[model samples]
Each structure stands twice: as C-alpha cells, then as structure tokens.
Target: MKTGIAHLPLHGGKAPSWLFQRMKRLAREITIAVVSEYGPQEMLRRLSDPFWFQAFGCVLGFDWHSSGVTTTTCGALKEGMKGLEVELGLFIAGGKGGTSRKTPSEIIRAGGHLSCDPEKLVYASRMSAKVDSSAVQDGYQLYHHAFIFTKSGDWAVVQQGMNDASKYARRYHWLGSRVANFVVEPHQAICCDSRGDTLNMVAVASEEARQSAVILSQLKPGVLVGEIKKIQHLHLPSRHHVDIRDIHPDRLYKIFVKTYEQAPENFESLLGMEGVGPKTIRALALISEIVYGKSPSFHDPVRYSFAHGGKDGHPYPVDREVYDRTIEIFRNALRQAKVGNNEKVDA
Candidate 1:
C-alpha cells in the first residue's frame, strides 16, 4: 500500500466536550455505514489510509488542519466502538500518553475475545511503536498510538509524534496487509508538515546500514564508544548541520552496556530493547556510515498532505454550524437507512 503524508502544525488544547460527543456519534454512524456496506476489514483498510482518515476526521467536525485531529478522531473512534466489538468485529486499543503503553494488554484482551492470537497482536503493537520511534529518527517523539484491528488479525496503526522544537506533529499509518517488512517501508503513510533530513533505518536504502548497526551492537562498550568518538571528530569540523548532541559518549556507553547484556541477535531485537531509543539508533547508523561506508537513508518519508482545509481559515474556514448540521444529516440518513440492521439492500 502507498503511504500518505501530511504536514500539521502543532495545536494545543483539548477538543470541546460538546464537539467531541458529537464527533463520537458521527463517527459511530459513519463506521456502521461503512462496515455494513463494505465489511469490517474494508473499514479497517480505510482507517489505515492517511487521506481517508483525515477526511474522516473532517466529516466528524474537527479542525481539519489542527494536530488535534489525530488524537480527537481516534478518541472518538475508541469511545464509539465500545460495546460494539462483537457486532463490528473490530477493536481499538491505546491512546495518547499513558494510554498508549496499555496497548499490549488491551490487544491481548481484545484478541482473547475475538479468538485470535494475542501474542502476535501484542508483538505487532510493540514493533510498530519501536519502528516509528527508533528506526525512523524524524525528530518527532511519539506520544500517541492507536492500534485498530479486526477478528481475522488484520490490523492498522494510527500513531502521532511531536517535535517540541518545531511545534509540529507527524502521524504514522500502518496496515498489516501491506507490511512485508516491519523495519523497511512499514508505514502506509507518514503525515507531517515539514520535510528535512531524517535518519530512517526503515528505508529500503538503509539495508546495509541496518546490517552494519547489528554488527556494531555486538561489539564491546568501549569499542563502540571509541567508534562514536571517531565519528564525532570527523564530522565536528566539516559538518555544522549535523547534530552531535545525540552522540553523547555517556549515552552510547549505557546503550552499549545494555546491548552487551541483552546480546540482541539482530537489529530488530536491538531496537526492541528498552533504553535503545532514537539517539542510540542514530549513533549506530552514523558509525555504520563512517566505518563501513554503508550510508543510511536521510530522505524524509512523508508522502503528501492528509489534512483538509481548517476551520479557523487555514487553507479556508469551515463553518462550525454548517459542519455540525452536515454531521446530523448524515447520522440521521444512516439511521433511517437501517445500515447496521443487516436488512436486505434490495428491500
């Protein structure tokens, strides 16, 4: 599946309670309509599409361009889907901040209910987070993660990360059906506002770098620190743009110690370990490039815009009253159509 990307300026504040409640209702109605017509799996596929997800948030009456769209829309979906899992054959787990950490347990519970493999679902949840946070060093630190899945094990992930310095947020989308390699091109789309140099270990071009990093992981801590120092010395004079802040010797020492203790057999295992974050990942990639001449991918993976015109006149203003009325109309139509009643279409 092709990945979609959009740039969204970070906007603060919670979505108003009145608006959020309406959003939940509208989202539920829309989900019911979609599932009734296409099936649960199809709805999951659409949710995994960044463009469709952005549009879905717009139709539910959110600020089309605000970063709140990602959190609020997913929140609405989670609330709307409650108590309807059996009927819909789908589950949404995880949310912003602490809620995101609960995804594994939530997935396990949902999998048990659905008679699916809990272990596999849990692994997917963790790996998706790991790939985005460690493998793709795009400056944004992930804070929100939502995993959506169906009874048949088809899953999708909608997660957002924030770059505090830039005041921008990037959203990552994943579809299980499209993920051939979790470390390379795993995202169906990455939505962000700005594109710059990023250390993307998951890029197809970074295969050799990834391999080199794994090899580096097995080395002694002192050896890794020496390699990092050499890298720092070489780049310090010539490259002003390269940020060596992440190349701290102390941090590298700690990461190397952890690596030695864990003895990760592969790059994926190294990344999956605790304390192995973007800084460590970037350090290894740089070392790989410096020593082995295996350059990592620096290309930003963001594809295109997923946000609609904003309500506060960003690209254009959306009329709040009109937007609410539109939702009401759609919700009423879906109810009248008996969309979720499983009635005969011909009748």
Candidate 2:
C-alpha cells in the first residue's frame, strides 16, 4: 500500500468489513514496525501523518493518533468530574499521556515530587497517563486525570468537566493568595486499593452525563464499550496499550463481582460503596468480555486527524481512500522491522 491512502475521505461511519479487516491487519503490522524501529516516544515524535493514526482509531476505537489535548471526550470527562463532590487529586508524569516506556517505580518517584500526601502521591504515580485527557492552553498542558486512592489503597481514574458547564463553572480562578476564589464541592477525591487493582475516578455530576457517554457509544461505532476476545481492543493502538477509560458505575459494579469470582453478595457490596473505580472497571470490562461475550467500544473518539486539512485551511475530515492508503503504508513499513516475527505476524 502506498502513502496515498492518507488522502481518502473520513466520514463518521463504518468501512466495509473486508476493508476494515485489511485496515486492522495493516494497522497492527505498522504499529509493530514503528515500535520495533523507533520505540514508543520516538515513533510518537516522528510520525507526522495523522491520517494513518486516525484510521487506527477507527479500528482500535481509542485514538492512538494524538494526545488528549483539548478533546470533546475529555470535555465529557470534565462534565462528569464536575458533578462529583470531592477534592480532585490528580497523579501524572510529563512523559505520560500515551506512552509507557517508564517503569512503575520511575513513575511513582515523579509522583512523589508533585505532592506531600502519600495517598494522593502514590495513587497519582501508579496510574499511567496513557489514556489520561489533557489540554494545551496558553502554552501549558492541563492533564485531566486523577487517582482515586481509597482508604484501602485501591485506585480509579476520574475525567473532569461539568454537564453543561458555563463560564463561571468551567472557569477556575487563580486567586492571588494560596486559596482559590471558588470553592469546589465534594472536593474531587481519590483513593487506592492494595491488591494491584487500578481504581481511578472520572467524576460525573448527573445522570445526563452518564447518558451522554452511552449516547456517544450509540452514535459512533468505536466510541462506546470496546470489544472482547481481542486484547488490542482494550485501548487505542500505542506502545504500551494501556489507555482505559472511566467506566459507568452500574457497569463497574457488575464486572467486579463476576471477575473476582466473587459471590452475588460481594458484588452488591462493591456497589453502593465508594472508590470502586476505573482500574476496577477495567478488570470488569476485561472479565466480562473474556468470560462472557459482552464488549465495549475501543474506537478512538478523536475521530478527525490532527493533520486533516480543512477546505478553508482549518482541521476537518480528509478523503477516505487517501486515509486508507496512508495507514497501509505505515503498516507496510512496520513489516520491515526486526521485531519478533511471530509477534508481528500475530499483530
């Protein structure tokens, strides 16, 4: 495949199954090639073609093509975060967001530098920034991710925003003094579980926010719950493949009970409880799909490519055929890499 596929049009619809399958195969091959050649960070830096990654998003459901910089999905997370009443404590590293080349211990140390509270610090540190949402504004990147460390040392991810945030609500005032001008209710909070479970928080203030997420799934094929059976479907195509979204409460509760081999009583206990979060949800999502047939959306919601040129010199959708060819070229390049032949073949 040539690089011309990048020029194809991109509509918010599904491609033909045969084409979709070929795209999937090519995406995996290209991803492996990139990983073998440049490693994670270098690949991210070198790949200037957004169309290829965007097509990968269509296949993977998670947008592995770009960082979570100013996304509407992040906006959805923000709306969800605003609805909660807790002190929001976030944990992240600068290199985080879409790569996991760093070790767990390394990331934890970086988290320690950011905070004094061991709970918040540890929670923030253990959580990877792969799928964490962020926005670059005024020459700064605001990472919208958190670690909900429970009293038990468990954690979950929280994506923040208001349901229909107005200027006063979305706007955070930087008070001259140590304290800010506005007081946040419930104080976005995070806790952790000791059992190697990642429980993070994505705050949602209203049923509307939850419903909106469900709506996103309904409207877009790759936006909702991801597929089971395929491990790659867990997140968008990336180096580490660890971008897990904040799951719904009802869904979270269901997975926890089933996966741990817990009884119905234990399942009910997890629900109506606090701090059972994203890591837990991830565990559940994995278990449900692997053990059961249910699946979730893993398609990248950042549908349009960053490199997509608009008709009026703005960012808009590009040609479909061009996009496919572009993705194919990337995949072909990966095939030439010297990684594990079997692994490459599997991908």
Candidate 3:
C-alpha cells in the first residue's frame, strides 16, 4: 500500500508512543498484505532494493538500533541462514573531524558473538590487485585502498551509501519486523555490512530506481538484472557480480603503463596491478568496447541517483506551494508522534 502520514516521524530518529502504536498497526497490515500477495523469495527480492529497505528502516525506527545491526546482518549465517531480524543504518561523520574508527575487525567485534569457525574470523584487507586512480576531493591524491573481510561472521560494512547522511541507508528488514521468516537467508550473499568495509566479489545492487539505471547501463554495458526486465537476460542484482568476471589482468597492466605515458602523473604507480579502480576501469572498458567489442558491464554502481521519472511524474515543473504543503504535512505528523515535544523536536 502507498505509505501515508504514519510513515513519517518514524524515521527522523526517535518515534513517539502514539506514532509507534500506529506504525505497529500499519506494520501488521503490511505483513498480512505481503504474505497474502507474495511469496517469501519475492518479499526478500523486494527488500533487496536499498530504497525500499531504507523505507522499512524508517518504519522500524530506533528499536532497530538495539540489535547491533552488524550482528543480525551476518550472524544468521553461522546457523546456515541468510540474516537475522536486522536493521540497516546510514550515518555520516560530518564536522571537520567527524571521525569514524572501528576497522573491519573492530566492527565484527562490535557485532557480538559469532558461532562460525573462530579461526576463520580474522580477515585481512582484500586490496590484493592494486592500481591507482585520481579522485576529485579537496586535493587530488593517488588513492590505493584494498580492504577485505573474512566471510565467517554476522555483519559486514561498506564505505558509502545513497546519501552522505546515515539516516538514509538500506537493509533487508522483513516488512517492519526484524524477523527474517526464512529457513536459510544466505549470508555469503551480502556485499557490505555495518563496518564501512566490504568483502570480495559480493554482488551489490548496481543501481536503484528504473529509468536512470536503464539509461546508464545502456550507455555503458553490462548484463541487465533486477527490475529492468525490458533488457532481457537479467538477474536479481546482488553481491556476486564482483566475483565472476574480472578485467583482463594483462590488458589492465598494459593500460596502467600506457596511462602513465598519456597521463604520466596518474598512472605511474598503478602499473601491472590487478585492481585498477572504476575510473581507470571505465576508461579501459570504453576503449575495449569501442576498439574490440569487449564491453564491461555498464551498470551504475551508485545508489542515490534515480532511474525512472522523479516523484509523481507530473511532466511539468514542481510547484513550490505544493512542495511546502508536503513538508508541512510531514512536520505536523512528526509533531503527533509518541515522544515528548523535546525528543521529537531533536528527531
């Protein structure tokens, strides 16, 4: 069902009791609708989208925080399942030094006890294949980060999200409940967890929405998957895509050396490396497709951009008056939440 005013004040942080009760009722209705309309796998498939998952996170609210989202993410794996009743979070450390510690290992530690093989718990950074790429940050720097984690735990982490704020991240909440309601949830399938770190070859959703993803993939190249059925020959878009195919090592090494020749400053260090980043990879992929018909998958890995038409598809420019009305509706609904005026105010 289309979300209503109740979905608001649910996500901005804390939820008031009255709102919580209302959400609980909504969640029940949603649960019944989902079970009646779709099978378990279909439900799981829908949750895979970061946007849908983030919406569920908003509904689940702070109660989700107590579960050590890290653990519930992968813990079910040790028991031969997908994930536990879990919540996904997306937070940004702003400020000059809005710092975040907890390396991959530390994050796993924070995720509570693991039942998997203890020896397999310790993981090393997976930056084996090294190549240099230029990133446009404050200053240009030759970046080289090869981080990886052991596959024997209840949580994972990644470096970025759909937005800079943590409040809008994604996870696989089953409706509004943390419960997975499955026999085996598939642990090895997740790409990133709570650690801001990732594992090797885990299939990640290359994009969200419909139109932009279709355009981006069409403009580039890749086997279409998930909701883009028009392209045919597609899959559910998961973590394994990263593992199956690899950039030809020989071609990559040569490209790196040549890059130094063309743009000497950027390519000097990346020569003969295994993992040449997305930019260099894109450059090589472009040349390969143009010159040799060997095109890498043209999926847009970024999550924030849209795929289909923007909100409601009005075809005309949005009216500012309507926009304010929408915001005011939510603001008022937030006011009606369960927490006191103060907590809700901060929320």
Candidate 4:
C-alpha cells in the first residue's frame, strides 16, 4: 500500500466520481480483509492510529496532504459498509459538513443490530466534538467528524477542523480504549502542519481553572457579568492562555441565567450546557484566570507526524487501469479466501 504520499495536493477535495466508486469497493474489501484476519476490534485500533489512517487514504488513491482526506476517506468508509454492517460487525457513522451533524441519528439507526447501547455512543460522539471545538480552542472550527465503532462498544473518532485565517486543517483522533474522561486530556493524537498557541481547557494543568469555572457558574447572572467586566478592558498575558472571544453583555447574561438555573457539577457538565460554546468557554476560562486567579493551560495538544507526512505534488493523476486492476485483484483474493479458517470448519 506504499504510495507517492509526498506529491499530494493539500486542498484538492474529493476524488472524482468514477474513482470514488472504485474507492468504496476497495475500502470495503480492505475492511473485510482486516476484520477477517485480526477481528473487528483490531480494525478499530488501526483506524484510530493517525499514521495507518492516512496510509489507508493513500492506498485508496487519495492525495495525502489534502484536508479532504479526513472527510473523503470517512465518506468512502461509511458508504462502503452500507448494508453489510451486521455481517461485518463494524460500523462507521458521520462525515463532513452537515453529515457530521447526523451522526447521532445514524448511530441510533444502527443500534438495533448492536450489542452495545447506542446512547453511550451518541454521547461520546457529541462530547468529542464539543471538546475539540470549544474546550480546546486552537482557532480551527470542526467541519468533519467520523465515528468508528464495533459491536462490543469500542469506538474511535477522526475529526477535522478548518482554520479560516491560516487556511489550514487540523485533525483530531480519539480511541475509546484510551479515554477515561470525555473532557480531560482525551485525545490520543492531533495532526497539524504547525503548532500554535491554543487555549486548552482540557489539558491536565487546566484542572483548577475548570473547577473554578464550574463554581463561578453558580453565581447570579449580574454577579457573573460584573466579574467578567473586570477583565474585559484588560489585555491577557501572552504566556497565559486565558482570554475571551467576541461576546456581548446581553448574550452572556442569557447563558449565565441558564447555567445558574442548571448549576453544572463539573467542567464536562459546564461544557455540555445548551448555550455554551467556544466564545462562552473562553469567557469562563478568562474570568477564572483574571478574577479568580486560576490559569488554564495554553498548551497545544497535537502529538504525531508533522502534518500527516504529505508533500506538494505535481498533479500526477492516478492511472485508472492500475487502480481498477488493483481493486479486481483484491476482489478476487477475498472471494477465494475462507473467512473464518482453522476453527471448526478447518478441523
């Protein structure tokens, strides 16, 4: 599956239709091969690994550096498994843009065939998105999310966010086996071209700040706004990560009222509050640091290959004959292979 990953186009979104059909068939066969050899859980493990996932897109004939790799690869995978989910015992839900928003409903639809509870899967999907977009503010707004899960309840997330100013895409990865908390240092890896100052409320060092924000949420709306204004006119220290985003007093008061009535018990709950978002989270973190003197961590949480190992390419379009031939070879091999070999059948 080695490829010319270095010559990939960074922004070339989606493979053409004729190629995508072949991609889906190849993706499906690959999944079958992996699941046949190592089992569904192992398949989940591979998808969660950033290196392997990127390599998978490359083998499927996608440009390595393209931001669309995240969305397009996930799309191919989801489409590939259409009616064989129960037989394969693996499932993929969610995709780019509005498709990402339909993840919960899709998971629920697949619930009837799963042994694991669907609600838990739905919550993990939402919390992962929440943490990346709001809890860890790296200035990239998430537009693509892919959730991969097995019948046993294990799951993994592949999500990407777009930075309008820098025009760069950052990807986040999560493995359920590695996560003990949805809101605290939960990502297994994040991939980006370069590191930048990020307001990371989910960092371990930000624990005190998180606690302080929850406690502050209990205050009256007017009282909270009063504390917020003290820092409104002041500039935040460069070394410090606490700073508010663009927010108006009236809007803040409304969110304050909701949190006041609900009284979130912890940082995760505070983040899950209906009206809470990146701006509001920044405001809370800012207030916690300035008014309450508890600073959140300014650490960026990316851990892996620098920018997914993709170099600029010279438009070397994929050869259809070779691509189609590759698919047929795999299709034939899988058709002839005995899926559950060396068990009762072999004996």
Candidate 5:
C-alpha cells in the first residue's frame, strides 16, 4: 500500500445530494466487488493507503483536492455500507465531528454481533486518534476519524486533522497489520511539502526525551510543578512554542499527580493516561529538552499533492452522464454475475 501524509484545501459546504446518492450506490458496488474478490482484509489494506483512498474519493465524484474528500468519501462509504456490513464482513464506524467520538461504542456493538474482541479494536481506534493528536503535534486538530474493520479483527483507520491557521488539512492512515509499535514512527512514511515547527514525540529520535518525560512525570507532584514553574522564568527558543498557560503550575500539579500515581512503564502508557493532551505533552517535551538535553523532533509529517477538482468546478464540473454510465456498467456486471446486492446497486 502506498503510504504518506496528504495535504488538501478545505472545501466549504457539503456534497450535493444528487451527487451523493449516486456516490452511495457506486461506492457500495465497488466495495462489494473488492470484498468478494480480495476479502475484507485486503479492503482494509486499500483504505489504509492514502493514494488509493484519494483516488476512491475522486471516483466517488467528490472534490479530489479538498479536505472534504476525506470526510465525504468516508461518509459515502459508511452510508453505503449500511445494510451490507454483516454480509460483506466489513464494518465502518465513526465519522466527522460528533460521530468520531462514538467510535468505541460502535466498535463494541459490531463486536457484540461478530464475536471478535471489541476492546482491542476500541483501543486501536482510541490510540490512533490520541497518537495523531498528542504524540505528533503537527498543528492539526483532528476533527474526523473513520475506523474500518473486518469480522476477523483486521482493521484500518483514515483520520484527518485541520490547521485553521493555514486552512490546510492533514490525513493520517493506519493499517493494524502495518503498525507493530504505536509510539515509534507508526506511519510507514512521513512526507509533506514543508516541515513546520511540530513536536513529534513519536519519532524514534525522541526515545531519550520520551523516557525522560516518563521519568519526570513520575516525580512527586510538588517537585514536578516546581521544575515547570522554573522553566516559565527561563527563555525558551521561539520555535519551541511554549506557552505560560500550558505549564501553569496549578494544572500541572494535578496532571503530575495522576502520572505519579500511575507510574507508567513507558512513554506510550504515559501518553494514554487521562488528561494528557497536547499541552501537557508539549510542556513535558520542552522540559525534557531543557533539563535532559533531549528534544523531540520538530519536523512536520505531511506531503503535498494535487488531484482532480470538485462539483464546485475548480478544474471542471463533474460529468454526470459519464459518472452515471460508469456506475451503470458496474451495476449491470454485478447483476449479471448474480450477486445478491446487485439489484439494490442497480437501483
């Protein structure tokens, strides 16, 4: 699978309903074809591929270069999979905004029906979200998460985060089979147009810093808070992006108490502790840099790419006649092949 971080412009509004309906049908048909020929795990592999996923969004008739492609295409797939998930042995949960938060419950519900371990899947879903948001702070706040899994427990994730300052979005892909370690360079590769200031604690080079962070967090709350207060008085490099609010002693003490009690064995465990967000991680990383002389990677992990335009007509408006004809051809082929859902797809 081709893997890389992707950058795209933010398109306003939603996909037109007429286009979305056809997208739903065509999306479902293509999914059925993939699952029948390659099985659900291979389908997961494909979804975990950024190139294939972007092409999929294009084929679904969404704006290929916009961030909407991720959310809208995922929405199309999830909407299309509605009735066939059980039969197809594939389940897609979570979506943009509020739907993203419901991923755990949805995973449990699917697992209850399928008999595979739900907790593992839930952990995968939650950790993937947490890693991209906190472990790798690349100026994007994640607002969309789509988790796709098979009945056999194979899984993949396609989540997007947006940088409001730049009006650009970054996409992250995860194939459970590809990720052996969540904290150390989980992505197969990191590519972007430009490297901005980012706190990439997940980078292998940050191993020492991560260890120091864990050790520092285990310090008594009072002692840790005292150290943080001292850092506030020192002048950190501007690129470090430290904020007074991030290391406020009162709040830091509370968070320190939790980590101190937990005594996390590793950085991954410390990261998963409750209330450990970007701010807390950032402060710890800065402290590690100042005191331990081990700074986290500040390289942004994103790549730039261009694709076909959208319904709004950047390059050209979507050709409805051709799009419809393509769907019809696939539906007819599936129908002739006697697939159970061919008739529904043809509709």
Candidate 6:
C-alpha cells in the first residue's frame, strides 16, 4: 500500500523544556504500549510510516504540521529509547546536524552491542543519507537524520530536509523490508508541501537517465566540459528558466576531474565519491538528457495537518495544560499496562 504523506510549513525555535520533557515521557509510554502489544519490528514500521509518524508527534503535543515535528519527535525517541534498548531490542542512532554525521560510528557501536554486522549497518546508514541528499533532488537540504535498528538488524530511517527558499520541510521514510533498490523508488514515502519540477534521479522512470549518467561519468573531463559549454552558450526563449549559467562550470569541471581520476565503476560508486553532491548529480543527469537522449524524471516526488499546530500558533496554538493532560493519560495507561491491567488503557 502507498504510505500517506504530509505537507508541513517550516517553523523555528526549540521545543520548550517543560513540553519536551512531557513529550519524552509520553513518547516512552506510547512506545512501551506499542512494543508490548505488537512488537519492536512493528514499532519500527510504524515510525517509518509517514502518516503514523506525524500522528505520533502530534499525540506527544508537538506541532501537527510543522517541520519541528520531525526533529522533536526523533529527539524524544532517541532519549526515550535509551533505557529500553536491551528490553525492546531496538536502538536509535544519529540526529540533527553534526549528530547526523556521527550515525555510522553510532551504528557501529550499536552493532557491536547487538553482535550484528557493523560494516553492513554503517553502509546502510551512509547510503540512506546519500540516496535522499543526492538521488532525490527535492530542493530540501537534509539537516536531520535518524536511523533506527533492531538487534536482528531490521532498520528504518526517518529524515527531514529543509528548503529555505520555499519555507517548507520534506520528510523521507525508508524501511529495510520495502527497499528493493536504493537507487530507484526506495522511499516508503516522501512528505512535503510543494510539488513541482525536481530532477529525481531515483525515480523508477529515470533508469535510462541513471545508466546514461554512469556512462557520461566515464568520459574525459575536457569532453564533458565541452558538452556543458555547448548548453551554456545556448540562447533560448524567455520562458525557458533553465540557464546553464546556473551550472557552475568550475564545480562541474572539478567533479569531472575527480570522476576521471577515481574511475568509479558504477552509479553507486560515483555517488559515494566524496565530492559528488546534488548539483553534480543534477549536472550529470542534465547532460545525459541533452547529449544522450535520456531524460531524468522532473516530477517532484513529494507524495502529499496539525493537532493544536505549534506553540507560536502555526496550524493552531498549542494548549499547554491540555497537552499536559494528554501526556498524563498516556502515563497512567502505560503504568496500568506494565502491571498487567490494560482495562484503563483506553480510558
């Protein structure tokens, strides 16, 4: 089934201390309920589901339709899961900004504790980030990444990126079970507000373009730059907003030089190279389309609301006291469930 998506307006400011503490407590209780009822894997699957993830954030008193939901929820989960990792058999690694860069090491550490293959987990962590940042060109620069894994190595990824120009955030979801090809149609769901033109290299429709990009990468730097120059010098109608001027010749030249030196064996290797980024990928895809007759997917992959939205009144103003009451209810229910009494769980 196609997972549901959400469009969230970007908002700023940290979640207040009181609210965040309660959110952590509530998140922990709900996670306990879920794991107790279903299982750890089920909890991971639900977190990887965009709709359910958003709802989970809302239930914890976060903004229902703001970018903060992604960061705040993941932060809470990371904190709440600390003491439960061994019992629940799941671990959360990485987070916003610099913490995200530490994911591979974190995964390796967790893998060591679980006796799973650390190399494989590290690779998964890196590739998942690369796929979203490079393969999916949705204009959102990813700033947050969260990797969740079970002791058996079953994993899910939930990350968010922001586009300052549009003032919106996009969330990407991935499940290990659902991923057949990391290069194509790998996301379980991508949620964002805006949908327009995007150079989606990961789209199923872009297979030919991807192949052509690999072939183009094998060419000499001079030859590749020559072709780019041809497009750069072209004068088209006013309606054509695509300007080769936007393509940095120096950056492309550098990428081509690196590609020639490294001689990457495949698309994955090319993407894994240190200097390759969204712009580099886009240029290669564009060149493939113009020079090789293979067109990349231009369809923006954004597949598709708030409790009391946020504290600053985004979707709606956050009700502090009511939010506290909601957390209290979950706390009580969790306590009852722990003692073998679930009759009050719904009350």
Question: What is the clash count for each candidate, in the order shown?
Answer: 7, 73, 34, 1, 4, 1
lDDT of 4 by residue, 257-342 (tens): 99999999999999988789987888888888777789888888765222212223313566667777777766666666665334
Over 4 Å off, model 3: 1-56, 60-101, 107-275, 299-347
Q: Which ten residues in a row have the lowest lDDT in candidate 2?
A: 167-176
Per-residue alpha-carbon lDDT of model 5 for 9-77, expressed as tens digits?
Answer: 776799999889878988998998788767998889888888888888888878878899999999999
Question: What TM-score should be assigned to candidate 1?
Answer: 0.87
Q: Compose the digit string of candidate 1's lDDT tens values, residues 199-313.
A: 7788888899889998888888999898878776664433223377656876679779889877887777888888888888888887887789888887778762323235455
Give the distance in Å from residue 56's predicted Cα in candidate 2 to where it truly belongs. 9.5
User: What count of clashes does model 2 give?
Assistant: 73
lDDT of 3 by residue, 64-178 (tens): 3222221221211122111321211111111111122223343345244334443332221111111111110111121111111222232222222122333333222111122
Segments in model 1 whose C-alpha atoms lie over 4 Å from true places: 188-193, 236-242, 304-347
**Deviation of model 2 at 126, angstroms:** 7.6
Query: Regarding TM-score, does 3 or 4 come out ahead?
Result: 4
lDDT of 6 by residue, 75-146 (tens): 998898778888888889999999999998888777656757877777777787888788777677899999
Model 1 gets an lDDT of 0.78
Best by TM-score, which number? 5
Query: lDDT values of the candidates?
Result: 0.78, 0.30, 0.27, 0.77, 0.83, 0.79
Residue 104 of model 5, lDDT score: 91
Candidate numbers sorted by TM-score from highest down: 5, 4, 6, 1, 3, 2
User: Model 4 — which ten-residue stretch has the worst lDDT?
Assistant: 1-10
Candidate closer to the true structure by lDDT (higher is better), 1 or 3: 1
For every model shown, what is its TM-score relative to the native structure? 0.87, 0.25, 0.27, 0.90, 0.92, 0.88
Tens digits of per-residue lDDT, candidate 2, 1-347, equal 00111211112233344433444444444444544554433323222223433443433322222232212222222233332212223222222243223324433553433334444433333322222211001111223333322222223322222212121111011111121101111122111111111111222222232223222222222222233224434553342122344434345444433433433233223322334433443444344444444443332221154432322223443444665676665555445443534453344
RMSD of 3: 17.9
